[model samples]
Structure formats: C-alpha cells, structure tokens
Target: MNSYSIPRFTMVLAGVLMGCLAMAAPDQPPVSAEKADERAGALLAKMTTEQKLELISGHNQFFIKGFPELGIPQLYMSDATQGVHIRPQLSNQLEKSVAFPAPIALAASWNPDLAYAYAKAVGEECRAGDVAVLLGPGMNIYRVSQCGRNFEYFGEDPYLIARMVERYVRGMQDTGTMATLKHFVANNTDHRRRTSNSIVDERTLHEIYLPGFKAGIDAGALAVMTSYNQVNGEWAGQSRAVITDLLRGQLGFKGLVMSDWTSVWDAEKIIKSGQDLEMPGKANIVKDAARLLAEGKVAMADVDRMARSILRTCIALGLHDRPVKDERFLAKFADHESVALQSAREGVVLLKNNGVLPLAPKGTGKILATGTFMEKLPRGGGSADVLGYNAVLLKQAIAETYGERVTFVAEPTDEQLKAADVVLLSTGTLDKEGADRPFALAKADEARVQRAVSLNPRTVVIVNSGGGIQMTDWNEQAAAVVYGWYPGQVGNRALVEVIAGLTNPSGRLPITIERRFKDSPGYGYVPAGEDVGKGLKRGEEMAKPVYPIEYKEGVFVGYRWYEAKKIAPLYAFGAGLSYTTYAYGQPVIAKANAKRGEAVTVTCTVHNTGKVAGAEVVQLYVRPAKAPVPRPEKELKGFAKIPLAPGEVKTVTFTLNPRDFAYWDVARHDWSVAPGRYQVLVGGASDRIAGEASVTLE
Candidate 1:
C-alpha cells in the first residue's frame, strides 16, 4: 500500500478502537506516573497501527508527531547541552538564549548545586521557547581528551560525573522540561563513531561507562538518546543486550529511548531492542517498520510499546495538558547570568601561580593581551555551539574592568612586551562533535607564549580548551597559568573578575593533563590495519577494515593509570590552586571497625590559614590495604567543596557505605567489597594528600 492510503485506513481503525476504549477513567491532577500510564494505555488502545507508527517516529528534524484526534500535541525538542541550540529554522522563534558555560566547565566547579542551577536556567529557557524536551546534560565519560564532544560532557571520573549529572537532571526536570541523558554507553570517541565498535568488558562498561547514566536514571530522568557508536559488536541503536538487557532490565529505566539523528542501522531491530523512537522521521524508519510488520518480522505489540512509552513521557511531563504554541520565551534572566558567572568563577582552575597574580587594579601598568582568543573566544564546534546572548569577549571584559590599561595585540613584538607591566597571553584548543582534536598547541601558539614569557618576567598565560592540552613547552616560563574550559556567554566577565581578585579560583582539574600525548593509555591504539582477533596486525598491503576501540585500561583510566604506572602528569586530577592557603586535619572515622553494608562517617577539619576568604575542595581517596586483584593506588570516593573565611575552620564529613569501596567483580557478576584494612586519605588534591585514616571492614 502507498503511504497516502495507509493513513486513511489507520484513521478508520483508530475510530473503532477509540469507541471500544470509551469507558472513562478517574481523572487525577498533578499527573503522576500511575496516571500517565493509565492515560498512555487509553491512548494506545485508541491509536491504530499506522497512527502509532507515525507517533513513534519524528514528525520533523526536532519534533515527534502526536495524535491530534485524541487531543495529544506534538512534542517539540531542542538540541541542548551548553544551551538551547538556535538553528536557522528556530532563529525566528528563538532569537537569542543564554549559552552558559560548557558542561566540562560546570564539572570543574565540583559543585552539584551550581550544576542544578545551571541546568534549571536552561530548562526555563526551554519552557519559554515552547520546547518540551531539552536534549542535554550529556553524561558520557571523558575517556580521551581528544574526543571532540568532550566539552559537552562532564569530567573523567565516573563518580564526579555521576554526581553532577544527577543534579543536572533534577534541575532541568524540575522546571517542567524533560532532560535527556544522551550518547548512552561507551561513546567516548568521535573518530569512526558510526562504524567502529567499542570493545569493552562488562565490568569496565558497568564501572566506567554506565555510572553517569545510572545516576541520571536514579534521579528520575524521563528520556535517553542512544549513541551513534556500536557497543561490543552491535550498534547501540539495534543492540538488544545494551538497550533491553542493560538499560531496561538492569537499570530499570522506564522512559522513552530514541535514536540519534538517522543513527539507526535496522528499523525492525531497533524496535525489537526496545528503542522507542527514530529521529529525523525522514529516515523512513516508520515506513520500514510498517513493511517489517506486514512481513511478520515486527510485532504490533512492539509498535504499541513504542507509542505507549512516548505517550507516558508526554503525559508525565504535563505536555498533553498544555497548549502547543510558540511562547516566545524571552531569555531575559539576569539572575541566571549571575549564576553563570558564579559557575565560571568556580570553574577557573589555577594551574600555576607565582606572586604576579591577583593584579592590583589601582597601580597595575599597561596589560598587553595577545592571542586570537582575546577578541573572539574559542569554543567547541557543532550542535553544542550557541550564539550566546550578549557574550563578553576577554578583551572587552578586561577593558571594562581596567579602562585604557588593557591592549589587544594579535602578535606582540619584544618591545611591546617589554614596555608592558604585565603580559596576558590567551591561548586555546578547539574540539567539536565530528572529530577529535590534536592533543597539543600549535607551533605558532607555543612560540607566542615562549616569546612573551622571555620578553617579560611577569607574564600570565590563560589556556582555554575543551579538556587537557600539552603545556610542557612554555608552562615553566610563565608566571601563572589558568585553565578556563570553554567558559560560556559571560565567561569573559568571570575570567576578568577572577584575575582581578574579585573572585578566588576554586575549580579543580577534572581530567589529568598529560605531559605528552603518547603517555595516554589510548594513544597508539588507533586502528592501522586488519585485526587478528586478539589484536591488530599491521600490513603494507591490506584492505581498510572497521577497527575496534578496546578498553584495555578498563577501570584504570585517567588518574588511575598514571598512579598505577607511576607516570607523573603535568597536572594531577583534583589539582587546583586557591589564592588563600588551607590546612587539613587528620581524618577521624566514626567507627574503626564496621560490619558489611554498614555506613562509616569520616570527618576532617579544614582551616583557612591565608589572609583571604576562599573555597577548598576536600578530596577523599580510598585504597585497599590488601587485595587479590591488582588495583590502582587509590580511587576518588567522596569530595566536599567548603567555603571558608580567613582564620575560620569547618569540619566536613562524608559517609561511605560498602559500595563506595567496592570494585566491579567480573566473576561474581556484581560489585564486591573485600573485607580488609582500607586507607582513607584526605587532601586538597588527589596526589597531594595531607592526612590519612584507616578503617577495618568485618
């Protein structure tokens, strides 16, 4: 049958079905999941097979069709992580929106409350713009610094990423917008993303790749978007093991699972694997599914399941009861800009500092700012990019703060640098969605920094990038180095404020800054030739074959590998410098001995010994006294960011359960905590521990 005749036949079938389900159910206000399920089931009973098929597929690039005959409205979604993406088509409706700092910068803040507020602002904009679903808070782990989409995700540590992601989900969902936890499972690489398979073990997948999604699920996220990559040997969109077994059965996610734009390999397989929707409906996924159904390859029950899930999500989000109109929501939240500024302020990590920092605004002489990034801020590319609403450039911000004192120069001569009291060198690396970035600075940028530092002793370099960059060439010569990870719209304002001593830098390094690219675990593992099952076999004459990105490092990613291998990085994980000084006290455990599954409270006192008020992130690392299997020297377990006034002390406490110290045991097929003496270290950074305490688990 042609597409035109199919819709007419389904309309008649839908009328008959609606009559059968005409018995009205009790109405409930403030829609709950129970009510949503009931409403969804009623709607499902009334939808014909053709109508259900259309409802499950995209109506357009960014919308899913709804049954207008049953009073259901089409669901409108927007591509958002940093902020609501303003596409050319959406420019008329959404002229401008707040592009807050990237997710990586938010993660650097190490404050979940701030992450919640950040996402809340984004969600508010979604509502104002009539966008029901905001596809954001991409929780994929930052496995490699080179990954183009790294800026769109949280940091490398799963625990940290999970914590931030949960709050992000809560913040967005609370504002009546459905938050989508995207790029599900082992989507770490952008190179060969569509064809390459991620060969990861079950334990590694559960430990490293799945925690962030699990945290979002526990936080009640209503939507999950599948990744473009393949997990194991099957495409993520068509893998029943990943979609059905892991997400639905193990994690207990009851939300709509949609495919990435045109990412589906087989329409029938996606439906059978529990994937609910196919994006860009132009992919003819619905048409193909219909053909499969006619051939007895796809079941009507599968179609009904898909339609019901979408309805449930819509009703639960209150989308069904509301009017579908362009709200033209003005992105006019000054308060949100304040929140964005605060987030940017907290996320600015001081990698290096001498006495040259906190430049006194009163008598500071000419500040020569040189770099391409000074005038035009360097931001990640692709859909994550948003034309920010009134974004302040670094040069503009510096000039605003220190009128007539800051000079912008693309290339500074030795005479120009020598004449300046201080040289502010701005440099950055750019990464986006389609490709990974080269892990080092360009030769010209390195030359600029080296020349500036040599010409003037008091030179401060500001490095802006998605993740880490090779800073070995000129880091030693600079007086200070600050890592500003893709600061959003008002990031320039925050940057100037931090440099001028208005705000103290408190953000820590979320990922390890390797001294060189070759030192990384994934470095040199790229596919070169044909695979020999165990590994690849390089050959001069061979056909290019699809390669697999093996997770050989397993749980030993980021700091874990560096510590275990004893390869010192340029900057350690959880490493951040504050202008003020902090003193750490010995960790005191509530109980020296505890039985299995019992919670242990660990407390430590942090004193601000410096002259200024500042915040310190108290990090907690755990290591087993003895274990059967080899493990990293330590792993981050808990952390708390404490704001302290000069001469003030605060006792920060953390509770740890069995799971906190547990490892993913492959043999047991579950998390296992070996009972033995465990050392708990507390400090300002991961490698710079100041105090330690031991606990015995019986």
Candidate 2:
C-alpha cells in the first residue's frame, strides 16, 4: 500500500469506529502508588473482560480508553518533539506556536541548560494544548548521517546524547507533561525500517546504542515508545530480551512501554513480553488478544498487569484528578520567541572563515543573496515539522541589517556576480521521515555553487541540513561556511546576527563531515535501490530476503570510526570555528593515581586570546594505554562550554567516575575497568588536541 493510504485508514479507524466509546468523568481524586494498586485491583476485579480489553488498546489515534464509570480519565497524547502538532492538524482557525530549533541544532549548542529550557518551552505548549503525554525527545544515536530522523535525535556520541536526553526528560516532565523516549533500541536507518533487523553484539549494543535510553530512564521518564524495527532476531515491541530483560530488569525502568503507530505484528508476543500498549490499537490485535486469552495463549494476569501499569502512570501524573480537555489554552509565556532566537544563535556553527566575516552592515557594497534557501527555510519533515508563527526569512533579515544594499536573486550571471562585492549562496538538504536523504547535494545546486565561487572570489555558503553534508568539492574555494541545521521560526534573526557579527558563533559539529559516503562506517551496510525491494507487489514477498543490518563497525560509530581507520574527514567532529581565538593551559589532575571507585577531578584554564567575547567548548577525551579488548582510540568523556572576554581566563573542571573509565565486558555482563595507564587529552575538536596529561589507575 502507498504511504498516503495508511493515514487515511488510521483516521477512519480512529474517528468512526471508536467515536462512540464512553467519555471519561472529571474531578477524580489522584491516588498514591499504594492507593493506586488497591484502586487498580478493585477496578480490575469489577471490570468485565470486554472492558479490560478496551483499556489496553488505543481509543483513537491519540487517546487510550478509560473506565469513566469508575472515575478513571482517558489519557490524551500528541506528537510534540519540537512543539505541539495537534493545533496545526485541527480544521478550525490554526493556532500559532513557538517552534524552537531542531534536536540536532540543540545538540550543536552543547549546553544542557539550553536543552532543558528548549524542552520546557515545548512542554508548556503541550500543556496549553491539553496533551498529557508528549511523544518526544527521541534519543536515537546518530549512527549514519543520512538517517532521515537524525534531526530529531541528540547526536553521534552516546555520552553527549545521554547528558542531553537526561536533562530534556527532566525539563519536560517537570512541567506536568509525560516525556516519551522514543524509537527505542536501534531505530537508526529509515530504509525499510519496519522490516529490517538490527544485528549487533551484546557489548556494542550495551556501549554504543543503549546508553542514551539508559540515561533517559535514569532521568525518570514516564513512557518509552518501542521502535518499528527488530533487534537481534526478534521484533523490539515483542522481544522479551529487549522490552523486559534489558529495559525493565537491567535498567530498572518501571514506566509504560508503548509501540510505535501500528508496529505490533503479534498480540500474544507483545502482551507476554511486557509491552503495555499498542498504538492506534489495530482491530486484529484487539480481536486476537481476546481469542488468545480464551485459548490459554495469554493469561488474564497479563491483562490486569497492563491495565495497572497505565493506571499507575495516570495516577502519578495527576491525570486522574485533573483531566484536561481538547480545548485550546493560550500560551502564558511571552518570551518563548526570544528563547527560540537565542537557541538558534548559539547553535549555528561557523565552519570556515578567511578574515572576510564580521562584515560591516552599512559600508559593505551591494550584497547579492542567491539560491532557493534564501526565502525558503527547510525544517525537517514528519512529526518535527511545525508551521511556526511569524517565521522571519533570511532575505528580510539581511535587508534589515543592510537596507537597500542587499539584493535577492535565484540565479546570478557573471556580470551580476562581479558587480556585487560578495555572493551569499544559500543551499540545503531536504529530509523527511520514512526516507533517508542522499549524502550529496543536488547536482544543480552544486553546479550553481561552483559557478558562483568561480565568478566571485568572496563567496559565503550557508548550509541548512538536518545532519552532516558532503562539502569537499567547493569548501576550499568559499571564503566562509556556516552550518545552520534547521534553525526554526526565529532562525533567520540568528543567521543575520551571526553573519553580520552581531553575535559570535559558538555551535560545534555534532557529527563528522566525511569526504564521501563510502568513508562512513555504515556505508556498505546502507540500503541501495535494489536492496530495498522496491518492485515487489502489494502482498508479495521476496524469494531471497535480506533481513539483518550487521553493525560491523561495532563501537566505532562516528568519530571513533574515523580515528580507528585513520581516515581524514572533510571536517572533524566537534569542529567549529569562532570569530575569536582561545588558549588552553596544561590539564591538572587532582591525584595522579587513584584506586577504583574514587572520582578524579581534571581542571584546565582557558583564556580568550581574540578581541571579541565568545564561548568555547572545552572537550576532554580519554584513551586507555592498554586494553584487553578493542576500544575507540579516544572517547569523549566530559566537556564544559564557557564564555570569556578577551584576555580573560577561567578554570574549567570535570569529574570522572568509575563508569566513565570502564568498558562493557561481555563476560561479566557489566562495565569493567582494567588497571592501567590512561591518557587525558583536552582540545576544542577531536583532531585538534591542545593539551594532555597521563594518569594511572590502581
């Protein structure tokens, strides 16, 4: 079936079939856990088998059925990673909302405080829209840059992604909206995601893929959305090893686990595997579950357990006492737009500069801005897309700074290019859910960029992409390059400030820019046209099937791969240029040698050597001198982003615990640290280390 047909079927099933379901009552008192168990038990005892079946399935597309007769309120959820999505889908007068920068852009900021603030603002919008659960904060690791959903994730490194995910979960849950950590396990690639299986070893899975989810659980997230893909040899939503053994037993997660929309294939397996809910609650599952129970394939205790979990979550969130309606409430905060602007400004990474930046807004000659992206800003597609209010265009912003001196053109000739003092060429890569983007820019756009650079010596290229793009062809010829990853509603204002020197660029690269797609670790394993099974009929299956996507690169996912293979990237991870410069002092360790389980403090002083004030992300990486098993050459352990004025020095410190220095040991089924010599390298980027210190572990 075509992709467009699925939504229509879902709408019909949700709107028509479930419309007559009973409505929930309001003003029910909230119950504590002890009280909730008693109430849940009582409710379960009184509920008929049919009523119990309804509670485990979706009442509609975005809601789950509740026992209104028992004063239980229905749970209302909405798509809300960036902002509320329900308002735009409504048929009445559209509601305006604050669309903050994409998750990748926020990851570029490398500021947990900003991540928290960004999520808080989104949570507020969810509250205003009367959404109980915000299906957001996707914590998938950026294994491949071409993954269409990378914009919705944190970043490439597990440590960094974990820190950001933890803070984001806390911020969103604090505002009374349940945060959902999603696409659980390895939902990295979008190509045939529903049918593909992610084949990974236990060690690599523990170290590289599962850390971010672990962090989100540690931060007290209330719900987890299972991915559509299969892990190991079983579907994630129905795999006992994934949903029960790892998430619930190992990580100690006690929240509700729901499947992605229409992701369940087997009702018996899902119910027995501890997956509490299946989204949109397909008819087959609802009917099959009842049959399975009658045939002894599933137990009544399983149904009761699932109902109790949902009830516990509702009680904890106070949804039982104060149920929200589908009515619109005005946003109370006035400074949401300002927060978006600031986030965009801090997340725009300055990739290259040749002393031509910080251009005087007034004195500069006619500035010709050419390209499709000048007027059209690309926000990532799918659920992350929000039609924000008052989105400022780049041309409008440039005109605001250089009135009557800036010209907008789709295509420029030699004479037009020569007449202008500088050419501002805008380009972008389009991304959407259900599809992975090509690694290279469009041919026409690439040719246009080359022609503009050949005609004008001082050409500035601004890239708007969800993830890293191939820029080796014309990067050396351009005077400057800035990567603005889907900067949202007020992104243009931030673009103008950064280009005109009104604000210093401090954003860092979250993923490495490889010279070519083949240089990436997942290159050969990525799906091609023929590998995707495109020509099969609607009900046909392939004679010979390719099922598993083997993670051959293991723990060497992003920068770790480049370092291990000794391949140079077009731009390194954590590579970002600033208008000002910084100087680093030798790193100082509180104790040269420490016993196991003791924390060590590493301190270093950073001085701003340039004239302007700017922020620098001081990165600390650790490498074990000798390991019994293989490891990344150097892994990012900790970092601190500090702002300083010219000639001002401040000492930044990072504390390392036992877990930071340990690697997952498959034999013991836990993290293990070997006693040996360790090297601490401090730098601004992975390829540009400035200082190093050696410490021994006893």
lDDT of each: 0.81, 0.80
- Model 1 per-residue lDDT tens digits across residues 1-698: 00001001111123222332232332222489999999999988987887888888888688889668897887788878788887776434566778788889989999887777778777877877778888887878877777878899998899999889988887787778888999988998776567668889988888788888999988888999998778898889878998999999888999989988767768878889999988867565666987898899988988888889999988887889875333543544665666677678778898899878787566558988888588787788877887777888988888887888888788778899999989989987877776677787777887788888888988999988999988888788889998888888889877876777777788898899899988887775556642211211223212235568888898888999899889999999999988889999999999999987899899999999988878889999999999877777898889988977788999999999788888889899788989999999999888899899999999
* lDDT of candidate 2 over 37-149, digit per residue (tens): 67667777888888777888887777878778988877777775777665444443226677788889989988776777677777777777677898988878888887888
Off by over 4 Å in 1: 1-30, 324-332, 529-545
Question: In candidate 1, what residue range of length 10 has the lowest lDDT sum?
Answer: 1-10
- What are the C-alpha RMSDs, in order, of all predicted structures? 10.9, 8.7
Which candidate leads the pack in lDDT? 1
